[model samples]
Target: MSAQLTAPQTPAAAPAAEPAGRRPRRGTFGLASKALVNGLLAISAVYTLAPLAWLLIASSKNRKDLFSTSPYSVGEFHLLRNLSDLFGYDDGIYLRWLGNTVLYTVGGAFLTTVISVACGYAFDKYVFKGKEKLFGLVLVGILVPSTVLSLPLYLLASRTGLVNTYWAVLIPSLVNPFGVYLARVFSAGYVPGEVLEAARMDGCGEVRTFARVSLPMLAPGFVTIFLFSFTAAWNNFYSSLMMLNDQNLYPVNLGLYAWSQNTHQQPELYSLVIVGSLVAVVPLIVAFLCLQRFWRSGLTSGAVK
Candidate 1:
């Protein structure tokens, strides 16, 4: 009678499974690791910014205040006066040096970008004689630092009587092997072979296909190469110094170096040099700010293909 009256017991419910792709809740260890990473990142940011901060402060101060004051502290803001001296000194020759730098950087960067895009596209799309070998040579060039080539470049420039001329700096910069490599990587990712085939089927010339179809796709590559060449040409002190002796043809980097060298005899030039250095940084800052979108977008350009 007792057994017959007994009822069946129910089973306990199972725990629910987490949804697919959802990350598990971070534990204390995970949180600690995240905090550690963030702290490191903050330290890096401060490390990178310290020089620029010093530059700003140094630029604002007179020479008397620069050495005596704390690096982060503000001083006698002779910024306006320093700028006037910077521009007005030596019949405004600093402006000429600035112009020289702009010309070299812009002209060289543009040419380098175009040539790099062309070469990279060729390496990626067209199968030809010694293609891989040629590309390998380019990779080799990347491994070889620019300083290694500076002497050879100077010798070649001398042979052609291009020394002390704008062409000396501009020519070598235009042949950026790194740019070519980047272009190839970009072409592989950005410019689809199908698009090129379609363009060809529609009777588009190779040059036309590249110009109308591939060039637009390679926008990120172009900006990256342009910035590289610009920086190379702008800070090209050793090559410029090796090739150029005439002050008239000197880039701002060399010009500033010359001023810095003379500072022992002329202590007042320190303010001018500091001000010039600050001003020199502005164009690069502006360029990066303007093209930063392209640079960021290009990061994923070669990531896929």
Candidate 2:
């Protein structure tokens, strides 16, 4: 009886109830924050896409529909008509301009990539006199805007009778300080000393090792340099305008500028110019999409190491 009474004195444990409304409050707050963030992101995405949307819509309109119809409206689809007109204009001069642009971009970019890769690799790998000073000079070149040098380049080209020629544009593009800097960074990260030493042990010459082993590893860097140089050359207006007086030698940028000026008098040319602008951007988009993997991989390769 005493044992039973002692046992009965133990207080009953408190009932374990669900947390009073705290969970619901927290859940509501989280949901509200997420909704706000999503809303903002949606708005930002729309804003970013708006210009491309307008360009796509505008390119589909003819001369009359461009001004009269709604800017965003899907008018009588005239994209094919516009393309035909663009190609047919001035005995297919637009096509010629397109070719010239491709040549300038691809040619200059290729040469620039080669030069940058060689210079950067040499600077990083070879021990030479005044290396720091030379690299410092290159950094100075990077700090100096290309526009500032345009006049000097023009004078030099004029003296050498290289002005008013494709070489005027191409040769200048071949010397990209930024590309060289990027190449140096890439070489330091990707081109390992151990691999180089192993290649040397295997009786590989420097040239052979670079061509076979190092160049393949530097593909990502090369692609990036190529794209940069290509875009720079393609969009180069001032240099091309200053260097090229002949309409036949004009790249798309200069050609478009010429068209833009005439658009004041020939209102119909306005539609063509818009359509041409839209067309011009396509190559750049294609190039980026195609080489995006290399660009991304190149950037992230050294993040861990």
Candidate 3:
């Protein structure tokens, strides 16, 4: 009896083979499920890409071809000519609008990133009265829709005589509460209290420590916030419409919208609007490609340590 107990009781009879037919059926079911998922994704991708495909084809056509030709078919290969006409129209106002968009997006995103980083760093590294309350207020602002702020912002801009000016747009973009929130998160993850304490022990002043020690670690987060702010300010339309009346100050998005409205009056503007849209997309694509690395690095930086 003792020897049999010590021998592992014949290995427990190997618990029956889970029915060989059931194994094949389970594998088939899994494959069918995978195929179904792949099919759904393909359909969704086609739906999303269909309009974009048409835009590319339509931008290459003249007005006559745009209305007449199949969406995917080529028509006279007028992309270069359409671009020329787009730029030459209204004394090259499209180029002017493009410049304006760059100004707004770049300037606003930069300032917003700086402000956010500073605010977040302070929140994470320092303890002060009402810190949580102030952060809670920032979170609340995030829940408030941007559109709701437009009317109030417009009213304020009108009162200050900033309406129809760059300040009207730039001022609002600088007050990004969401950036502040992200900055705090990044600070908590990327910058350690121990590191900050060491900097303090080294006789470094607060600003000097943050500038030299904390900032480099926070670079990825800054890029992420800047991308968000840039996209928001670049695509901004409702606020710009509410604040600006002058065509000269209109960003590329609003300029495109204006051109769209006039398409019925001048059929050629239809092609210009389509081509101009494609042009507007180029900078964003380039920015995304260049900055995507920073974003990916940021997502994983705080996870490990």
The top-ranked prediction according to lDDT is 3
Tens digits of per-residue lDDT, candidate 3, 30-53, equal 899999999999999999888888
- Worst 10 contiguous positions by lDDT, candidate 1: 296-305
Instruction: Name the regions of candidate 3 deviating beyond 4 angstroms.
Output: 1-26, 298-305
Q: Who wins the TM-score comparison?
A: 1
lDDT of 2 by residue, 160-272 (tens): 99988889988888899998999999899888887788888889899998897788878888898889988888888888888899999999878989999998898888988
Ranking by TM-score: 1, 3, 2
Error of 2 at 71 (Å): 1.5
**Model 1 off-target regions past 4 Å?**
1-26, 296-305
TM-score of 2: 0.85
Cα lDDT of all candidates, in order?
0.88, 0.88, 0.89
RMSD to true structure for each model, in Å: 6.6, 6.5, 5.1
